[model samples]
Target: MAQATLESAAAPRESAPAPAEAKPRRSGKAATGLLTTVLALLLALFIIGPLVWLGVRAFADTWTYPHLWPDSWTTHWWQVVFGDKALGVAVQNSLFFAPLTVLVSAVICLPAAYAFARFEFPGRRFFLIGLFAANAFPKMGLFVSLAALFYALNLMNSILGILIVHVLGTIVFMTWIPSAAFAAVPRSLEEAARDAGASKLRVFFSVTLPMALPGILVAAIMSFLASFDEAQGTYLVGAPDYMTMPTQMYSLVLNYPTQVAAVFSILLAIPSVALLLAAHKHIIGGQLAEGFQIK
Candidate 1:
């Protein structure tokens, strides 16, 4: 009888109903999830709306004051802009200058970045502060001086002039980015390679470079975009003959009052987006994502 009673008690406890506490908790979670989804939708609309509007306006045949939508939509603006020989030339020039700037900037800045990140250089802080300070100054501030220098050197209106200026302007930023990237690499990895009889150069090439590649790639992409999209200096230095897309856009705006300018703007953004996507893999590569630990 005692055994039977004990067995019955255990069975009832084991088969008991679930506590009511879990019911409210599940309901709270579902409500929170619904609120989060609504917030995300709102944020997406806020960001994507402007981009969609620009695309719509670019395609509009006749946009007017106080108009929410164009009276008619057409591809005439795109056809005209793309069909122009000058537009083709501008695209060519931008393509050449942008990649050249990225390459030159990377080459020139690599040594400086490595030194800053790895060595005990004198006045490093001062150099870094100066770099940030230089960025704060408007590009326009140097236009007059740069133009005068170019004229004196007989480099005005030359592609070389544009390329050199873009390289110099982008170097400061490229160096800083890679310096931070190189610094994020643990010194222990380099030491281990050395202990295994790897030379400094070898270790750098095999270990250090690969480890810091993502940041380097990001910096390169940024430099490319900056050079590609730069308007002010390119216009000042590359006027008349060396018309970049930006200079062409200016010419169009001055001569025409249509949405052709928006077409150019959209086309200009293509290279930037393409470059970003190309570098996206590197930006999220396993080595960078796991090893670098950069915030």
Candidate 2:
């Protein structure tokens, strides 16, 4: 009788219906998931909507007010943007200056980054803070203040002047990003290589650089984009003769037909988009965040 009673009680406990709270818990989770998915889709729509509209306008011959779609579509605006000689010069200037600026920044800033990462030096903290301050200053105001110096040095309208301006803006990116990258590298690996009969230089080149490459690559991409897109300083220092694609947009917006401006806008965006896509892997792999961590 006792054994039978125990079994009967255990069976009742095992076969009891789930707690009344269980259904509501499950329903709540499902509701939360549905809300999250809806929010994600809305955010995506907000970002992509403008780009979709821009694409529409780029090929549209006539997209008047109140029209959801273009009345006519043609590729003629593309041809117009390509055939313009002045615009071609601006495009050339952008292409030529951007890479060259990256090179100059890499040469000057990489070693400084290495020093910042590896050594404890006087004023190091102050210098790092200074880099932030340089970037923090109001960009247009900074450029305006420097214009007087450019005039004094006859740097106005000169390639060297424009190059210097671009390099100035990129210094913080080149220094800060690579410094964080180098700091994150394992000193143990470098030391082990040194113990295995590798020279310090060899250890650095073979071990440190490879490990920190993603962060350095991210920095380079940022520097390249900064120099490529800089308009305020470039316009202030090198206007009229040295107008890059961004600066040229000002003229286009003012004087050119709307479609012409749209086509040029697309062309201007292409290189930046292509580069960001190329670096997308490194960026998404957390190197960008790693480099910006200030550690």
User: Which residue pairs show backbone clashes in model 1?
Assistant: none
Tens digits of lDDT, candidate 1, 1-295? 5334544454445445545555555455556656766787899889988877877878998878788899998988888887989889999998888888998888888888888888887898788777767777778988777888899998898878988878867876588778878887899999999999999999999999998888888888878878887888889888888988877888888886458777887998888888888888866653234322222
Model 2 lowest lDDT segment of ten: 1-10
Q: TM-score per candidate, in order?
A: 0.79, 0.90
- Alpha carbon lDDT at 240, candidate 2: 93
Stretches of model 1 off by over 4 angstroms after superposition: 1-46, 63-67, 280-295
Cα lDDT tens digits, model 2, 1-295, are 4334544454445445656555555555556656766787898889988888877788998777898999999999889999999999999999999999999999999999999999999999899888888878899989989989999999999999999999998898899888988998999999999999999999999999998888788888898899989998998888898999999998899999878888888888898899889989988987777666554
Clashes of each: 0, 0
Please give the distance, in angstroms, between residue 295's alpha carbon in candidate 1 and its true position after superposition. Answer: 14
Prediction 1 global C-alpha lDDT: 0.79
For lDDT, the strongest prediction is 2
- In model 2, the clashing pairs are none
lDDT of 2: 0.87
